[model samples]
Target chain A: NAGVTQTPKFRILKIGQSMTLQCAQDMNHNYMYWYRQDPGMGLKLIYYSVGAGITDKGEVPNGYNVSRSTTEDFPLRLELAAPSQTSVYFCASGLRGGGDEQFFGPGTRLTVL
Target chain B: QQQVKQSPQSLIVQKGGIPIINCAYENTAFDYFPWYQQFPGKGPALLIAIRPDVSEKKEGRFTISFNKSAKQFSLHIMDSQPGDSATYFCAASPITGGGNKLTFGTGTQLKVEL
Candidate 1:
């Protein structure tokens, strides 16, 4: 079902630059999420969407934005990138409720210089 | 607030040995716990999960032991192999709302030597 897919497998951005990490799921999941993983650290949520038009901030949402215009797409935007933003980003999708298991994408390795 | 806490930042085990990774949480609202395993350069994948109603759940060579009173849970790998080496993360979610809003603990890197 192509569970979850993310674009730009790897990327490097200069300070002040901006980019969007794309995520899609064919499972028709109603919940989508964006998370960042630092070296030797657990993943921290950046943003999430309950549905196409409902988005909310998570643990670490600074310097990031998200849009869920369609059930299949949830993209994360990083504006004015900073070195501290250098980390691996993952996109996941799940069913409607909180007990559902999430399907994750391969991940995008982003470097902000 | 670091809702979930995991210990043994790293572990090394001989082939065929059993490796256990531990985690604890402070939130009583969390009723679902799941473990994810991630290899280098890859995203984390669900291994096994247990709810507070069950004390143990086993899948293949992986097992999850949950303790409701202690607010703790653990993952154990039986007859560990080199392929089992990876970073394991324990996550919890509240019983309400979007269940996928997981609170993850620091990962435990497991290495199984042949």
Candidate 2:
């Protein structure tokens, strides 16, 4: 069913380069989120959307931006990416109510040189 | 405050052995507890979950035990196999807050060897 999918399985960028990480879901979920996983930092939320056209900042939103253009697409943008921004990024989606499980995308591993 | 805390940054178990991972939460408002499993390059998947109203929930080889008073929960992996080697994460969210937000633990890396 392609519950959730992420693009650019892997990428490497210089300290000042910027890029986008794409995430999409086919379950018709209205809630979507972006989280980054570091060695010991668990999963830290960077941004989230309640529905298309609505987005909000999460715990770790610095140096990152997100937009919800469609119910199935939420893309994350990194501006002036830094070495500290290098981490594995994950995207997840679920029903708005949220007691239900959130389906996660495979992940995007980005290395900032 | 970090709402959730997970123990044992890493663990190793022999095949067929039982591996347990514990997690505790400080927010009493959290009514939902979920465990997620992540492979080397994959996103975390919902392994099992339990609610405050229930003491335990089981699905095949995985189980989640919850304790409301202690504000804690745990995941028990029975008859662990080599393929079971992966990272486990514990998370908490308040059902009242529309529940989409999940506060995750640092994670536990489990290695089951033959």
Candidate 3:
């Protein structure tokens, strides 16, 4: 089903620059999440959506935004990037929320300088 | 505060040996605990999971042992192989609320030497 897919497998941005990390899932999952993984660390949630038009902040949502306009799409936007934002970003999808199995995409490695 | 904590930042074991990775959580509301395995350049994939109601769960060569009172859980790889080497993450989430957002532990890198 191609599960979940993310664009720009790798990217580098200058300070104050902006970019969008695109994600899509063919599984028609109703829940999608965006997480960042730092070196030697686990994932930290940036933002998530229960469905199209419903988004919420997660543990670390600063400097980022998200939009889920369709069941298959959820994109994360980084505005005025900073070096602290350098990390690997992952996009995941699930048929249901709360303890449900989440399918993850290969992730985009982002570097902000 | 880090709700979930994992130990052994890295582990090396010989093939056929058993490698156990441990995790602990502080949230009493968390009911579901899961372990994810990630290979280089790839996203994390679900390995095995356990609910608080069960003390243990096994799937193939992987097993999850849970201690409800201690709020701790562990993953054990039996007869480990080089192919089983990967970064393992432990995560927890409540079943009802917060959109089931997961709190993850710092990963443990596992290496199996032949």
Candidate 4:
């Protein structure tokens, strides 16, 4: 399987601009997640979905949104981007939601200017 | 609040040496602990993981030691190599609320010199 895949390996957005970071998994995972990594800060969950049509906020959900339209796709949206949003975003998928192995995509490097 | 804490922002060790990275957590609800390794410009990958039930686990040259009473855990790399140089992260997750949503600790950048 391709596992999890994310689009736009890199991007730079102006303040107030918006963009969507796309994620997909071929493993048919029921759980998908969005996380941001800032240098030594490590990964922080932004949003996650238990399944299609069920999305919830995570540790750092502000300034972001997510939609899981299908088992394979979970896309993260950044609206009115700010410089504070500059970080590397990752998309991950897992067979189950609790303490299971998560497969991560290469990640998208986003810079808000 | 940062529920997970990792130590040593960076570490450098020679090849064949054993490097240990430590982590502590404040959440008692967390039952699963896992470590992820990220290479430059790439997403993190699961290296090894352990549950609180097990005090220690070993997989190949990577090992995880857990101290339930101390709420602390550590990862040790035996016979480290240059290829093992990467950012390592310690993460924890509660059993409730879709258990896979992890809270991560600050990463430790490890550099193994040949």
Candidate 5:
């Protein structure tokens, strides 16, 4: 049940440097997300959480910052690392949102330099 | 503003031909229409979904064709293989918000050439 679980996977920040992009989930979801894939686009929703401590703000939430304390964690904090903040970062979980069935992970390829 | 609008960003189709992508939305309170599939580096999987009270929805060859009063939604990849190429997204969710996020579009890069 490693449903959703993302970690370093890959990173390279530089511009203003600030990291932290960890997400976890073992089912028991309650909606958690953080997407960013900008090459041809699609997948935006920068932050979301709807359970442990409730976080919000989506649609490219500026620099980005999230925290779900724990319901299997939700972390994504990229202070000033701008290179347009690179791309490819996904961490999803679901059990009460969108159209349900959304369990992704296996991604985190930041490269802001 | 790009509130979900995707089109022929790219497409090739040949393997068995039949690849349509199209997506459109301006939030008519969207009705949960999804389609995601990415390859080359992974992440982005949920391959098919539709619910505008259902105009169409298949699973085998992956199909979803909703048009809830023309807010639009499309994705049909019948037979086309080559592992179905990659990149294909079109999302819209608004079942009353609060956790039903997801409003994407601006992706379509299929190339099932054989």
Candidate 6:
């Protein structure tokens, strides 16, 4: 299996611009999550989905949105990007629940100017 | 507040030496603790994990030592090598509910020198 894959390995956006970071998993995991890692900091969750059509806000979900229309895809949308949003974003998926080990994508390095 | 706290922001050790990274948590409800290793420009990967019920778990050269009473845990790399160098993160999750969302600690950058 390809496990989890993310697109646009690197991206740069202007302030107020928008873009979508795409994530997909071939493992048919029921749980998917979006997290951002800042320099010298731990990852902060942006959003997550327990299953398709069920999404929830995480600790830092202010400037982002997510949709999990299928078990294979969970995409994160950044609207009206700001410089504070500059960070490396990761997408992960797990078969069972939050207690399970997650498969992560390579990551998308995003820069907002 | 930061639910999880990791220490020694960075660490450097000679090759073949053992490196230990520590972490502590405030939430007693957190039952699952995991360690993740991330190479530059890559996402974190699970290295090893421990549950509060267990004192220690070992897998190959990696080990997780847990202290339930102290509410702390640590990762130890035995006979460390240059390839073992990376940013390590410690995370915790409640046994149930919250969709298993994890609270991550500030990472520890490990460097193994020749």
lDDT per residue, candidate 2, B1-114, as tens digits?
Answer: 677999989999999999999999998878888899999878999998888889999999998988888988999999999999999999988887653689999999999999
Candidate closer to the true structure by DockQ (higher is better), 1 or 4: 4
Clashes of each: 1, 0, 0, 2, 1, 1
TM-score, every prediction: 0.97, 0.95, 0.99, 0.98, 0.34, 0.98
lDDT of 3: 0.95
List, residue by residue over B9-102, the lDDT tens digit for candidate 1.
Answer: 9999999999999999998999989999999988899888888999999999999999999999999999999999999999999868663689
Mind giving the per-residue lDDT tens digits that candidate 6 earns over B17-50? 9999999999988999999999987889998888
DockQ of 3: 0.84
Model 4: how far is A82 from its true place, Å? 0.8
All models, DockQ values? 0.73, 0.70, 0.84, 0.79, 0.32, 0.77
- The TM-score obtained by model 5 is 0.34
Q: Which candidate is the best by lDDT?
A: 3
Over A67-111, each residue of candidate 4 has an lDDT whose tens digit, in order, gives 877888999999999999999999998888788988899999999
| Clash pairs detected, candidate 5 | A98-B100
Best by DockQ: 3
Q: What does DockQ come to for candidate 5?
A: 0.32
User: What are the chain A TM-scores for all the models, listed individually?
Assistant: 0.98, 0.97, 0.98, 0.98, 0.32, 0.98
lDDT, candidate 1, equals 0.92
Interface RMSD of 2: 1.3
lDDT of 3 at B22: 96
RMSD of each candidate relative to the true structure: 1.0, 1.3, 0.7, 0.8, 14.2, 0.8
Clashing pairs in 4: A97-B100, A98-B99
Model 3 spans > 4 angstroms off:
none
Best by the TM-score measure: 3
Candidate 4 CAPRI-style tier: medium
Kindly report the docking quality category of candidate 6: medium
What docking grade does candidate 5 earn? acceptable
Model 2: per-residue Cα lDDT at residue B55: 95
Pairs with backbone N, CA or C atoms under 3 Å apart (clashes), candidate 2: none
lDDT (10s digit) by residue, model 4, range B14-68? 9999999999999999999999999998888999999999999999999999999
